[model samples]
Target: MSNQTEYAYKYIRERILDGTFKPTQKLIESQLSEMISVSRNTVKKALLKLERENLVSIENNKGATIKSFTLEEVKNYLEIREALEGIIARSAAQHIKDTEIDELEQLLLRMEHCMKQNQIDEYSKLNRLFHNILYNASRNIQATEMVSMIKTQLMRFHFRTLLIPGRNESSLNEHKMIFASLKNHDAAMAELAIKQHISNVRKTIENNYQYLL
Candidate 1:
């Protein structure tokens, strides 16, 4: 992609993942072009890309907005991840090597230190790295690509819940268990760990059931 498109994608993706642009918000081409310091065409390309990913929607009447997710959709997302990630972890265990194990260890250590020090930025980076290691090990490029996109969408909620009390610590411990299961090459245990991890995310907000309505 050209520099302009790259900038456009990065800007829009950040806003979408950070909840800076909420659902049903207009994505006025001219205003976005000005705000992102990109051309209107570039902004259009970015918006179209998001639309293809179901992260944005445009209509002739109401125009564009961030996609508002229903609770059913949220449940479906987790269910898919739970199923796919379990298989991914199982498949990954067969292919994971010593070098990959070392990389995972490094990521786990970073996560542990980041949690202890309360370094959200570093923690988040290591968090991504930890999962990337498993994704790569899954050895399914198509699934890897799709999972990355879904992961980005889930991150909006993940980061939000991180700000809630006790979430960070809980997240750290869950990851530690996942790392341990993977380290021992126990795919079934890893699968369960993945489910539990996602379940913890689902339980974060007491009133989140309202989102379904």
Candidate 2:
């Protein structure tokens, strides 16, 4: 990505994550440029890209704003995520080698360790690695692409939900079972395990009822 793109993605994504910017708040081009010390053109281009990815909405006459979703939309996104992720895990089992499997195991261990240490930052980074590896393993562009979109839309909910009390341990155990299924080459088990993981995520997000649609 270009420096402008990187700047915009990081700036906007973090604001969205931290709630510094509300969903309906306008993302003025000049304001972003001044805030990030980038040029107006760069901000405009970045907003365009985000819009293309469905992460934001730009009105030709009214400027851009963070995309707001309904509660049902969030649930629907998770339902789609569950189906796609399960399929990805199942397909990955056929192609994943032992070395790659070991690498994934190490990630689960790291995630477990991070939880014990309360290393939220490292945990989130490693979590990304786990999912990225799965996406690559699936070897299906369409499926991975859909998951990427689902993840992008759901990123805000992850921190609010996953980092909640008692959720980390639950996630760690779920990952272990999924890893075991993958290690054993049991496609059915792997699929079921992944679905369970995602279903729990849906629950976590749902439990945060104060979080609007």
Candidate 3:
């Protein structure tokens, strides 16, 4: 892709992932082009790329709109994440470096502080970084890419999971367990801990579907 198209793609994709461009919101090429200072064709190309990523939809008559998911679809995505994230944790336990473990420890400390201060957004950012370190340590490129893609699709819902009452504490505890397992190089325990974490997240979302939606 040309630089202009790439720029437009990142601009639009960031807005979508960050919830600025909400689900099912229309994407007008001309408006986006003006906003991003890109040509309409560039915006169109960018939208097409996002559509391929399942972040947008384009139809015969309609130009483009942010993609929306049904509850079942969200659940299905979480199930897939649970499986793949478990594999990642297992691999990370075996392959993670000492420095990576230290980094995770620091992130966990920061996360705890965030929880105490009621800084959910900052905690969420740190949480993503924590998993990203594990993803790199796992040395499983294919699974990492798949999980990352699915994560982008579910980014909006993922952040809201922390908003549920008492979830922040529970999530921090789950991460501590996973971190301990990885620090000990216990692959089985690491996998179990991460799977349980994702399972709890799924259950929380299911029980509080109305709040999440």
Q: TM-score of each candidate?
A: 0.89, 0.91, 0.96
Clashing pairs in 1: none
TM-score: model 1 vs. ground truth: 0.89
| Clash tally for model 2 | 3
Question: Compared to the true structure, candidate 3 yields what TM-score?
Answer: 0.96
Query: Quick one: best TM-score, which candidate?
Result: 3
Deviation of model 1 at 154, angstroms: 2.1
lDDT of 2 by residue, 63-141 (tens): 9999887778888999999999999999887777888898999999899899999988788788889878777777677
By the TM-score metric, which is better: model 1 or model 3? 3
Candidate 2's error at 49, in angstroms?
Answer: 1.0
lDDT of 3 by residue, 138-158 (tens): 978899999999998988788
Query: What's the CA error at residue 211 for candidate 2, in Å?
Result: 4.9
Per-model C-alpha RMSD: 2.5, 2.0, 1.1
Off by over 4 Å in 2: 1-6, 211-213
Model 3 lDDT on a 0 to 1 scale: 0.93
Tens-digit per-residue lDDT, 1-213, candidate 1:
788887898888788887788766778999998998889899888887888888889787665788877766776776777677777777777678889889988888888888789888778878888888988888667766766777766667766666666888999899888878888888888888887887777666334544422
Worst 10 residues of 1 by lDDT: 204-213
